[model samples]
Target: MAEYEALIIGLEMLVELGIQYVEILGDSMHVLKQIAGEYKCLSLSLAVYPVAARNLLTEFREATWEHIPREENFAANELAQVATSIQMPEDCVQRIIKIGKKSLPSILTTGMEIDVNSAAITEDDWRNPIMTYL
Candidate 1:
């Protein structure tokens, strides 16, 4: 159930980025089966998710869902656990980026295309008392 929420979040991120094809890996066979139309989603609470996710899949040229053993999914599991512990500050801008094995790239893209580096300021900016007092 929670796994499908995570998967939905990833799919939403990809849709926002205008990405058209994706390969998704998950350890939840039930969620994958629901997405693949191999099983019926019987839970009233979760019945809507498959339809919503499938609508997102329609935006893609191709979408593949695969199941992997939890032991083989250590990195993602660890990262998700770690993510739940962090609190975002009120002024924080959130971005979602997909990273492959070789390179680190910025995830700060949105419909408005925020430029994170564009707001760079001197050390004095961080020390300004008036701004800090607020």
Candidate 2:
């Protein structure tokens, strides 16, 4: 509903996927901040959007609210326009779906010493469950 289309596009995709976390960054810090509740909303147009944003935010597992320069968000802005004007296939938007892809932390760790003969419990078992799924 805002002037820019990306914010609405990103939000729409998130809702479809049931995404729980999102980072909203834009040169429109005043707008973004107000939406994120970092500032008070003073504009009639701005006021309505933030209310809806906050309500949807409660659904995320963890939403990282932030603000960045417009240069950083240009790509998002363009995408928003495209998304607003037409329907985008999920495959076409794959790049935006995953902004970064770093390999997951090593889950396979081997014991430095063979202590099968000794029964020694390690605290790491509870500290990091994903280390060894087996």
- Name the best candidate (by lDDT): 1
* Residue 113 C-alpha lDDT in model 1: 28
* Estimated TM-score for each candidate: 0.58, 0.49
Residue lDDT tens for model 1, 1-134: 56766666678778878998899888888888998999977665566667666766888889998898877988786887986677667887995544543111111121222222234446579646765687
* Candidate 2 per-residue lDDT over residues 9-78, each given as its tens digit: 4565587798877776666777676666778665543454555556556667787756666677676668
Tell me the deviation in Å of residue 64 in model 1: 0.6
Those runs of model 2 whose alpha carbons end farther than 4 Å from true positions after fitting are 1-5, 77-134
Best by TM-score: 1
